[model samples]
Target: MDTEALRWFQLVCDGMTVTEVAHVHQVSQPAVSRSLARLEAEVGTPLLQKAGRLLRPTYAGAVFKRHVDALIHRLDDGLAALTELTDPRTGTVAVAFQLSLGTFLVPGMIESFREEYPRVRFRLEQSHDALGSSMVAGGRIDLEFTSRRPRNPAVRWERLFAQPLFLAVPRRHRLARRREVSLADAAEEDFVMLRPSWELRTLSEQLCADAGFEPRVAFEVDDLPVVHGFVAAGLGVAIVPATEGEPQPVGAAAALVRLTDAGAFRDIGVAWSRERRLLPSAELFRRHVLALKGGRMPTATA
Candidate 1:
């Protein structure tokens, strides 16, 4: 049915004369009268009746007006909800990252962002880099933090920081006392690493290959802290990242030595799908992260 016709019917039924409704709507009296007639014809019933000089709604007209009123109310509510969803100060952002970032990098970034947008909320997910990038491409996550660029063409990866790889050794190990050591120096040592599914694991292997020997895998672990514990216990030495600003503590159990090899760094970055439009809150978060690209990201204490 024509909504404008129904609106005219409602106005006339509320005791307004046809001439008055026409003047209020800025239409001619004949145009308003024709619209009412069309509405009556469509409904096959008289919706308005003349009572002296004013018009009043018939039973059918009153029922239709109530339904129209409800629809209008719902439309208004939907519009308001859409506005809030896009508003930077009132929206939610969903982000995904590798488990390693949870300890230091992600938390600090979130805290800083919340300081600026106090009303914004977050839904955070921790997963391995591959799955995190897949979530972003699938639209399950608005953004992702990963150690390497995603292979998916739909996702755009922006480099945020380049963290140098470090050699983690037991405190009693000979190389632990060195300020910097070459990967070749520990070629014979057993290596503890993240599972093969992790990007860091692949990067570690590639670095070993570049160092001219394959690292003998002693054990595979998923968590960075567990890797640290194993290295501290002298089970194995691992290649780890030196996150900017956050240094790995050299305790009696373990020490972190810088890798002397040139270009031995992992590029940490943010990824998002190009096909999906980000909410205002997500966009703000993206801009904030991009602004920090020139700066350093804190690494997890191994």
Candidate 2:
């Protein structure tokens, strides 16, 4: 069961004399012999035998060596991988981001990071949780590029920037020609919205309230693009983000108008679990992402 015994048995089987193996290991020949004896005893077979003058493995030892070789090889590889994971420039980082940011913001940041740390590998994850991403708190991810700042104390958030929210309406709509409009101006219009669980939906509702009118809900969808599509189809109007970091593309059927109201922009940032220590690679990548902000403070309408 001792690894040293198995190793000695393997070496002896590989044609090394007990004396030679002991000399190489700086032990007595009897020590090597004892190790071989214990190994054969444990395996319940004579693994090594004297063939004329050279020491060699028996058929059973030859068969067992293959399994031992594989085990040792895997163990060594695992140790190396663990060591590599701590190397800042050559380690792996696991990153998670909201689905909306995947189009531009998150990917652009990752691409820029890889340019500097080409040797570093990344594991990417995407989440659509509308109530604020919880992957960090659960330690499922090292960092998350998200729009809503997490409310969990276990998760730390950094304000990167704000994505300005825009009102998208059909090109033929009365307010479509306007470059900018008040949320109150469209209060009576039927609204195309993401599900109520979505953060943007919550924001739209609050902004509508501040504007002194509740948006009449009409169509509900799961994704921003779909919400935009509904607006373009004249199903209803929807609030969307634009002219900012990786804003979703608006189709020609829909026109985006800037909103003139308090808190019209959503804060986009990164979240990480404070309870877990990030590997050197991930920590460095986090720094790289933060630096991308270029000292820009988040803007809020309210």
Candidate 3:
């Protein structure tokens, strides 16, 4: 296979016009055209067809693109691993985490990590707590910080912290007068809740069910920031993990109250696949996580 030609073809598949790809690579249009012809000849099929002045990939090209994308991703991962192995301090670490980790855990640890390894680069992704476990399990990310622990046999976890759930409400709401609220009390009110798929939402629902009432959901959203906004706007109250205790919503009024009968709390942790060997950068992250004041490593699962 002509790796260079295939790479150029991949770029064209990614919405780059022939002239654009040529310009980026500092090659003439004729050179790019020749390379594409050579690639199509080698593959024994046309990869793209002209649609007016623009080129679009054929059905076969679409299939090839999926395979090529996976190949390119694996190659990139390999390069990243090689860079780490050659110079661990100068390589990049790709981490994915839920918002709470981004808001609370990463800021402090990233500062300390960068001070010790000044050359290390980090690529961070903030995802919902619901998807964090699956992202780690599928190898889409090196390390994941999530509130929900994976039940998958292929994944391993380390408990980082436990945060108590608190009722956040607009200050003018009737319930805002209370210092603390019971789960039963919360169930009676219209709630602005996390989407049902989220771990926090599942926990809230379970708690409400235990209280013998379904929560009256007035609004539903995925982000805590948005949830705070809705609650602050006097839409309804919600239960959120009290990681930093009380958080004041900007441009909105809200207060946090402890939930009495919501006996359970959410556990935030780092999860990674047990089947895959940890990359050097990922191992460094594992060390940093363990070093957190309340973090504890779990026993390796069989």
Candidate 4:
């Protein structure tokens, strides 16, 4: 398995003809074919077979390509990391955060960080809340800004702060005028809940149970904002996080009543793999986040 043969084979698997590959590589068609043959011989199988006028990978070739694709991806990441290691200013930090935190929470932190490290690069992903722990543990990302605690042994979660949760009701609802209310007060109301897989869904359910009644779920949704929308539409009440200062009609439409329950806040945290060391840029960003413990995230203007 020569590297040149592997590259040529990969291109063919991507539907390149031998002539086209030769044209791209500025090599003779015979040269490309010879490379493919040697590659197949090394693997003890025909990697490509004629399908009419076109060439396609055999089942074994396709499986080999899958692993090759992963290897190539890891290789690219390694090269990038090597370059970054020599030049810390150009290092990239990979981050995964909850969609709920994207609007301002995560963005604000990133904005502030860039102020100090303007040339540092970042790769960001918006992940579902429940996926944070698993993503970090699996090495899919360097760090995750999440509200849920990681249950995996290889992952560590450090609480940055506790964000207060609220009971959101339609603006015209009778209880909207109150500054605070107990979970039991909403016991008889229809609930708009996030899907069962969401940790917030489970937390809301447990809160209701502690209040001595089960929530009669009227709507099931996929995300936090949708739950807010459903609650604002008067479909049902919901448990929601406090809105940022940014003007959101959805926030304005849904009157937030502070929950009187003892545990009405969720711990906001950054999670990372304990089994793996962080890259230089990632470690810097993690330290920056830790420095902000119990402080508000700096806005874009700041």
Candidate 5:
């Protein structure tokens, strides 16, 4: 049905003569009358009745007017919401990141962003690099922080910085006091690491390969905290990001030894689908991350 004709029918029902509605709308009276006629034909009923000099809506017209009023109100609201989403100061940014970054990096960034954009809101999702990359490609997330660059052609990956990888061992371990250690140094030691599906695990394996040894897998876990707990309990040592291996306590529950091997770093960056257009807020957040200074890798002390 024609929305404009329905609107004209509603105006005629509001105690305005057909000629008056035409005058208000700057259209001919016959044009207005034909619109109402089309509306009545479309609904297969009489929508208005001539009551003396004024036109009043019939029962069917009143019912149709209610539905039209609701549809128009919803359309107006949708347009307003679109305007707000495109507004730089009021839009919402949806972000996805690896679970490890949620501990410190993402939260700190969000807090700083909020300081600058108090009215903007955020929707955050935590997943592994693979899944986070998929979310960005599928347009489920506007932006993603991930260690692995997405291989999909439709997604764009911007390398923010490389985070140094560290060897996490129990506090009392002999190498814990060492300022730097090679992966080959722990070749014989049992290794606790994330599942192979995680990008960090692949990076760690490659690092071990570069160090000239295959690490004996002792435990396979998905959670970062669990990996840390197993290492702290002396089960085995694991190569983890500097941020993840940083000592949380003053004395250190586990010691983070710097890897002496060359190219011992994981590249982290923001990813988004080129096919999707980011909201103003998401674009601003992306710029904020790209503009961040050094310290992508937290310093680990022996």
Candidate 6:
């Protein structure tokens, strides 16, 4: 429990002889042994046991050292984060969003933001589209990118642009040959879907319901890449947004069919708390992203 005793114990674990630990601490060998004995007494167990004339840590001593080391490291990190928070140019940005948004939005935003504030640090938290909105509302995140505008009055949404969904199928599949596929035609086949709670999942379900039937969900996953992977593997077809760099052609494995009949598009936008004004770094980031000549993100709503 004593700090000095803990330090001596660490030295012992590092292979310091009791005589050497005593010498470093400017104490006698008896003093070192008494400190170790007192520590063992307080802990109700022997932290070290005699191995011939040398001492070695017992199992409990090894575990305790690991715990102490981790605690000390975390304390150091906590202090560093506190210091970072007080400096605008060097603060941490906690931005949360869905993976699709990360692929489409964060890269551009980060590149521009870093150009102006090279010292700014970031902590990204990615979740499903639906979950990102909730994170902003719950005060667990600083900013969020969501496909659907938040309905909760506690948060504010700014409509950036529509990310239209498209049908993706293996290139060799019959539907892949179409110039643009209708949802009705594609709905008849097996489909890989996002989980029902996701914004994309809810939208996909609604689009299929409008066509007069629920999609026969052949496989469901939260990750969009996995959806693409499934389509590439010939497991089932899927619907995904036409992200600018998307459908990274899987070696004749998949093709994208713009779904004209689905008549559905996810509104992509940024959201933050209505009660809080934008921080300087956040405002800088917003202005940079919106200033692009043809970029979708626009000014925040009033």
lDDT of 6 by residue, 91-194 (tens): 76778877776654676677667877899877799767753345677765777777766778888877667777889898789988887877888767899988
The 10-residue segment of model 6 with minimum total lDDT is 293-302
Q: After superposing candidate 4, which stretches have Cα over 4 Å from the reference? A: 1-81, 131-133, 243-252
Which pairs clash (backbone N, Cα, C closer than 3 Å) in model 6? none
Q: What digit string (tens of lDDT, one per residue) describes model 2 on residues 1-302?
A: 88777777767767788888889989998988888888889889887777887778778988999888787778779989988998888898888877767777776777777878999998899776488547878876898888877788888989887778889999999999998999988988999988989888899999999999888999889988788788878898988877454444555488889998979998888889888999999999889888867453322221
C-alpha RMSD between model 3 and the true structure:
12.9
CA lDDT for candidate 3: 0.77
Clash pairs, candidate 3, are none
Per-residue lDDT of model 5, residues 83-152, tens digit only: 8899978898988888777766777778877788989888899868543336787777998878878878
Point out the higher-scoring one by TM-score: 3 or 5. Answer: 5
In candidate 4, where is summed lDDT lowest over 10 consecutive residues? 243-252
**Distance from true location, Cα of 126 in model 6, Å:** 1.0
Deviating ranges (above 4 Å) for candidate 3: 1-81, 84-86, 131-133, 245-249, 262-264, 293-302
Worst 10 residues of 2 by lDDT: 293-302
Would you list the rank order by TM-score, best first? 2, 5, 1, 4, 3, 6
Candidate 3 lDDT by residue in tens digits, 1-302: 77667788898888889999889989899999999998888888899998876678999988888888888788889988787754768767778877755655666666777777888877888777763345777776778778777888898888877778888888888788898788777667889987877878888888888878998999999788888889888888888876552334456577888888746578877788889877776678678777874843222222
Q: What lDDT does each candidate get?
A: 0.83, 0.82, 0.77, 0.84, 0.82, 0.76
Error of 6 at 297 (Å): 6.8
Runs of candidate 2 exceeding 4 Å displacement? 1-8, 16-46, 245-247, 250-252, 294-302
TM-score of 2: 0.84
Where is the poorest 10-residue window by lDDT in model 5?
293-302
Best by TM-score: 2
Ranked candidates, highest lDDT first = 4, 1, 2, 5, 3, 6
Q: What's model 6's overall lDDT? A: 0.76
CA error at residue 53 for candidate 2, angstroms: 5.1
